[model samples]
Target chain A: MNISSHRRTRDRVVTVLTYAAMVFVLLLPFALFVGLAVKSDLLFREHSLGDLLFSSVWRPSSGEFGFKPFIVGSVYVTLLAMLISCPICLLSAIHITQYAPTRVAKVVTTAIDILAGIPSVVYGVWGMVGVVPFVGKIAGWCGIQSNGYSILAGGIVLSIMVVPFILNILMEIYRTIPRELTEVSLSLGATRWETIRDVLNRKALPGILAAFGFGFARAFGETMAVLMVVGNVVKIPEGLFDPGYPLPALIANSFGELGSIPEIESALMFAALILLVVVLIFNATLRWLIIKAERY
Target chain B: MESNMNQGKEGRNIERPFAEGESIIRVDGLNLHAGKTHILKNINVEIPKNKLTVILGPSGCGKTTLLKCMNRLTDLTPDIKVSGNIYIGEQPVFGSKTDIVALRRKMGLLSQRPFPLPMNIYNNIAYGLKLRGKYTRAELNELVEYYLRQVNLWDEVKDRLRSPAVRLSIGQQQRLCLARGLAVNPDIILADEPTSALDPVSSEAIEKQFAALSKDYTLVMVTHVLRQARRIADYVIFMYLGEVIEMRPAQEFFDDPREEQTKKYLAGAFN
Candidate 1:
């Protein structure tokens, strides 16, 4: 066949086979995560894995399994990170997009581009070496734990890490706004703030909200940075400042100590399953919001 | 056509060749610079009160630029210098410490694209009046209803005021934009290629609406379409290459265009 005709001709068998194989490849890890979590046979080798998932006491010796604490810690950190990051990220994005003089906008965008490129591990190390002491001092003053390794400290670090993500996503969203809308609003005698509040923000708010969900997803899945600052206590955190072990920390801690108890290993896998579900849900929601945002 | 209705009252100036006699806005020696390149050159014209004046031009002819200058919208761009006396009514527009908001209150402009604020239909129309605080809930409701009805969109949208203006069809959105502009009670309305994106039906509807609006508000429009210029213009200003080639009564303009380029343009020999 001629090259033009060949390009147009669809081979139904190849197309179907190709799509099925592609789906299988994509589904490989998805299937694995679910398989490892729900497999009752994996429970035979060491019931500790299944026990820690369901028991109130998560210790392997007593065969107590309870995943509620790690789930709670992840929720706390993610929520705290969102609380700290959302407005700051949006304001920064707005400033860069609308208020900054052209030169200032250029510089701010460049800075954020560089900030977003910084590795999450480096941010984690910074939280450990620099942020920990500062947080300790502040927490002590507030009659909270003197340890820097608290859910609050980790959450703040996660916020710092996710702010760039929020700002970058929202900046792109802001750029998509037609110049006509802003010019019309400003021409109508709306002040800078009014134009942004009534015209600009309302226009971009959907994408900004989607960015918040993405930031939460990133914060929820964060392991190393949260691990460094969070005290890794399995108990439920009493306040923002209290120490807690998130799912990633639980997974990380149990990985090295897996030799000590086989049930702990099972529980770690169970925790992995939970973290996987949470991040997936967050990602799905974020994607839905972004799609909805584009429709508007 | 309804344009003829509005035209009969305002087009003639006691046998003075039908210049914009009431002179709602006077432009004298206006020089607009875009990065040191003069875009509007030594311009002089008068736009009449409560009449439709259409500015016809080839592309890059500075008609849209001139429309924006009336409200100082051009000032928002950096490196664009304007040296001109643009007087709106009795006030010197370019140099007044005029409440930019209050100044914007007196005039409204529609862009080529219909940029209804990323807001509901009601809020889009309510935006301007709310800014200037002319809105009692009853007044705002009355005004929105009045303007929407005036734009011939009230019946279609009265049920969906909370729906985002973006959801409207392009023609409906343009009319919604017109209603938004009128909601604040502006004396002058400038439309820049307002129907360029719509089908013939929409363009005709907008033309009819502009004719009706001219009874109460001064209307200025910039268009590249000669047929549109013929249909709605009371006074036609023809611009070619950033200069006003001719300003004449609309009938005289279409009947015997003064400039060769204007003749060529009306004859459809390239923009």
Candidate 2:
């Protein structure tokens, strides 16, 4: 009886510790949001939210701060990266899971894991050396003047960086589907490609969307690689060849000089808050979608 | 008993006559190896057209493996070597020039568990039909209804055609899978323990459907249940440890066994 009581006491303590850990994790994002909001209150009090968001001017000396260009840059570069990455990732994942031999698929997945583990700064360096020049050549062929560092260059690099993330999720989705489903389709006269296109792809659609959401969030908040190739020009880009500055780039570039300038710290804090909120919203929506998909 | 069984294995050629009806599928000297383990050893059998041919054996005896080889479904397994000649009608199964898709289209398969395509009930039936050729919406509707009725599922599902196929009970899902397979218009139907995952009622329903379907399609089934085999199998092929122990008409094989293994199996000596 005494030993059983002691064991019960230990179990209760462990349960309490687990709940405490979960609560701490659950509150971290809320704490970060509140801290950011409080710091940005100085800028919010001076400028209306709409003016701060929509105005295009960014003269810190005269106290004119606008986030429209950076917002557009983040959206444009992230969308460009997704457009470049989605089809390649989807097809590669299908091939690896459905067609490639076991040994070959294992090798390919290992390569993807290494790619995922590479440092972001290394990707930035590679982008400067390779992607910028390729984009410059493409711009020249298209009769546009570009100095190699532009949104297109950033997009190419960012797309390559997120390929592993998207492909990993897609491959996992395909693998979870029962082997029986594939055989049933095959025995019904469907080719391998037909089975993937009709049955497997349809089943994995929600997971594909969730993968794109994750890739989008990763590309949107990427700091070093996008900052390196995007040229960090504070203007709304007219086209793929034009220079632009995303929100993360703006905060990274100006964070060191924050105390010397009045209200600048608040503005940067506001930018961080915006990035956090957008990523949170996207992730929440994807979670809701996955749950709904599973229900049916 | 062991020596008698060895003699039965040695004298396989003289024990049973070839299937009396027109043979739809013939396997000659079929051998399969997965990695280093030999899964099927020198199988020779014939499936009669428009008959219920049940491959009976204990678990892990390659009954399902032999059934899968008929439709070339075994090709999906990795690191497996299949060296054999299988003929369906006049077409060689593994011939270099054979169209695998077309060959598979001629054979429908029912797995141990129901696997409905991830789609609405209507689309699940329509999927195979769409693969074959373009059909008008009216024609697709009529054909889907006809196949569903063939499995006796039309009345139960007529009102919920647009609902997801997975919403049905386990029994209904198996029937839906049957309808989906039949939609491809296969001449041969292969079932690998199709009722193993079902309750007794559902198993009975599926058995009734199989019995009815045998009048039109050449049905090959794998089952370990002796009672079920006795009830449904017009022809029987008994396998043990990757070898065909006996092949004969179901009545004769059950009533008068030629081999000690067959007699022992019939008397419930061992699974």
How many angstroms is residue A280 displaced in model 1 relative to the true structure, after the best TM-score fit? 2.9
Winning model by lDDT? 2
lDDT for each residue of candidate 2 in A79-110, tens digit (9 for 90 to 100):
99999999999999999998888999999999
lDDT tens digits, residues B130-220, model 2?
9989999999999999999999999999999998888999899999999999999999999999999999999999999999999999999
How accurately is candidate 1 docked according to DockQ?
0.53
TM-score of the first chain alone, every candidate = 0.84, 0.96
Given candidate 2, what's the lDDT at residue B243? 89
* Candidate 1 wrong stretches, greater than 4 Å: A1-29, A39-56, A143-145, A187-189, A259-261, A283-296, B1-21, B35-38, B75-79, B132-139, B159-162, B259-264, B267-271
DockQ of each: 0.53, 0.66
Candidate 1 per-residue lDDT over residues B30-134, each given as its tens digit: 789988688998677778888899999888999999898888887667678877567787677777566666777788888897998877898888888788685
- Candidate 2: the clashing residue pairs are none
Predicted structure with the largest DockQ when compared to the true one? 2
Model 2 alpha-carbon miss at residue A245, Å: 0.8
